[model samples]
Target: MRAAEHRRELVTLAYPVYAELLSGVTAGIINMVWVARLGGHAVAAVAVATNVENLLLGVIFVAGSGTTVLVARARGAGDRAATHSAVRGGWALWAVITPVVAVGGYLCREPLARLLLGGGEGGSLRLATGYFAIALPGIAVLFATNVVDGILKGMGDTRTPMRLAAVANGSILVLDPLLILGCGLGVRGAAIATVLGRSAALACGLVVLHRGRASRRPAEAAECGIGSLGADARRTARTGLPMSADFVVRMAGALALVAVVARIGVDEVAAYGIATKAMYVATMAFYSVRQAAAIHTAHLLGAGHDQRRAVGRQALLLSGALGLSALLILLTAAPWIMRAFGSQGEVAEAGALYLRCLGPYLVLLACFIALGGVFEGSGASPALARVTLCGTTLQLALAYGLSGWGLPGICLAMASSMALQCAAVGRMYLRTGRMGRTERPPATGSEADRPWIPAAAASDETH
Candidate 1:
């Protein structure tokens, strides 16, 4: 495809993904708003509960993200059996994993709540345990909805997932007041509302999936290479585990950075917290482009095309523009942005300075993240995950060493770490491009089931 065509396709896929992600974030904020009315204890309870849910999301990515890539590849190959296998793999993995998480989490609710709340026996601890009782079991619905979304996105339908997110979040918005305040269920009400909202969306998603089943007919087991339930599940897990690990590592790194910021001052920590939330608006856009690139690259590769270089270039350009636009906006309106979040005085000043100093890091991060998607689509995610692990560790060490200089020092550490990561990915990209030049397109549909990376590129990444 032409460069213009590739760019256009990426934009089409990315914008809806961005909207879906943004809606989820907005809903979480609004959910917190309603919970905040019950006082600090309620807020604390919901906060920790939601943080646990966020971590749990990484676990489901094994099913959700793996299905996306595999289905996209199968679709491109026009292999109905492969598509069936991919979808089955996602649900199979979900079935095996969900029970352990939901049932085990429920049984350990009180202990989990206490651990999250620093082992307190206060009202917050009780509220959190109550919240967990409902939310943990309700996670099954959330996992199912994510699998539905992955299937849709693999079929190149990003808008449907965006609409589904809106549906779920809208339901939450309407239910929150009624359940939490009007019904007097307190923190448990918040958890209930969340579960009900997601369940409603999942029902609708299932209906959609059913209606579209004609396109994904049942296939002969012999035609689907890894057709057995166990084999399919294992394949999905293998494909997605690296992506899940990457997400978990990043989350852990972000949490660890808070400790380093604490060494600066309490106000700085508060500023860091607020600033990070604000930064999500920009980061979501980068990730959207990344997803777009991954889907597009995988689809094309499955069709026996090696267009990773083209897709990566367009992804970088789109995400780079987004990063530059965000940098300019933050630089000019940092104070206003901080004020809009209801911060003031030392908190606002520190946050504004941090935002202003974030330009280089954001730009570098945008490029690295966008490029990482190309790797994810091409079966190079293990290498990408390793780079993220190293970069995150380096970021923490640098931040601790530079803490005396305050938030700007933290920003410096982030930018430096991201720069190194980008260099590593860039080298991988160049080597892959060189390898692609000498490669022939796959001659059969079964070849689509194989990893996309050439031996030369894979060898380079391993070393």
Candidate 2:
């Protein structure tokens, strides 16, 4: 495909993903808004609960992301049996994982809340436990919905997932006030509202999945022979585990960075928190492009094309533009952005400075993150995950050493770490280009031993 065509397809896939991501963030903010009226303890309880939810999201990525790449590849190769196996793999993994998380989490709700709340014996601890009691079980709904979204995205339908997110968030928006205040259910009500909203969306998503062509199986597909459930589950887990590790490492690194920021002083820590939230707006856009690139690259590869170089180039271009735009916006409007978040005085000044200093780091992070999708689609994610782990460890050490210089020093550490990561991934990208030219695609069943050729591509390479 032409460069312009590749860029256009990426934009088509990315924008809806961006919207869906932004909406989820927006809903979280609004959900907090409703909880804030209940007082500081209430706010604290819900905040900690939601943070746990974010971590749990990384766990479920095993099913969701793995299914997406596999299904997209199968679709491109027109392998109906492979597609069926991929979908089953996702659900099987979900089934095996959900009970452990949901039921176990509920049983340990009090202990979990105490751990999260620093073992405090207070109203906040009690509220948090109550919130967990409901939210933990409700996680089953969230996991299933993510699988549905993954399947839809793999089938080249990003808009539907965007709409489904809107449906869920909209329902939460309507339900929050009614349950939290009107019914006097407190933090538990917020948890209930979230679960109920997600449940509604899950119902709609299942209906959509049933009607979609991707979920259908004809007699011909039966002839193609579906893999056993254990085999399918293992395949999906192997494909997705690296991606999930990458996400969890990043999340853990971000959390640890907060502790490093705290060493600078409480005001700086507050500033760091608000600034990071604002940064999410841009980061989400970069991730959307990454997702789009992964989908497009996997699809093309499944169709017997080695176009990773082309897709990675476009992903970098798109994400670079977004990063540059965000940098300029932050530089020009840092103070205003801080004010919008309700910070003032020393806090606002510190946050504005932090935002202004974030330009280089954001740009490098955009490129690194975007390139990662190409690796993921081509079955090179294990290497990508290793780089991420090393980079994150380096970042924390650098940040700890540089805390003396305040947020700007911290920004420098982040930028330095991300630059090294980008160089690493850039070398990998170049190697793939060399391999594409010098080597034939790997044989079928040999993908496990290869680095760049995916299983689907291995089967379809002759095309």
Candidate 1, residue 133: Cα displacement in angstroms equals 0.8
Tens-digit lDDT track for model 1 on 1-463? Answer: 7788889999999999999999989878978999999999999999888888988999999999888887777777776676777788899999998999999999999999998788969999999999999999999999999899988888888998999898899899999999999999989889999999998899888888888741353445344454457767777787778888999999889989999999999999999999999999999999999889888877876666767888888999999999999999999999999999999999999999999999999999999989988887776788889999999999999999999999999999999999999999999898765422211122234553454443333232221
Go through the candidates in order and give each one's C-alpha lDDT.
Answer: 0.86, 0.87
Worst 10 residues of 2 by lDDT: 435-444
- TM-score of candidate 1 relative to the true fold: 0.93
Q: Candidate 2: where is the Cα deviation over 4 Å? A: 218-221, 433-463
Pairs with backbone N, CA or C atoms under 3 Å apart (clashes), candidate 2? none
Query: Which candidate ranks first by lDDT, i.e. highest?
Result: 2
- Candidate 1 positional error at 301, Å: 0.2
For candidate 2, lDDT tens digit of each residue in 1-463?
A: 7788889999999999999999879778877999999999999999999889999999999999888888887777776767777888899999999999999999999999999889979999999999999999999999999999988888888999899899999999999999999999989999999999999999999999877555864565467656467877887788788899999999999999999999999999999999999999999999999999888877887776777888888899999999999999999999999999999999999999999999999999999989988877766788889999999999999999999999999999999999999999899897784423211122233342243443334322222
Query: RMSDs, each prediction?
Result: 4.0, 3.4
Pick by TM-score: which candidate is best? Answer: 2
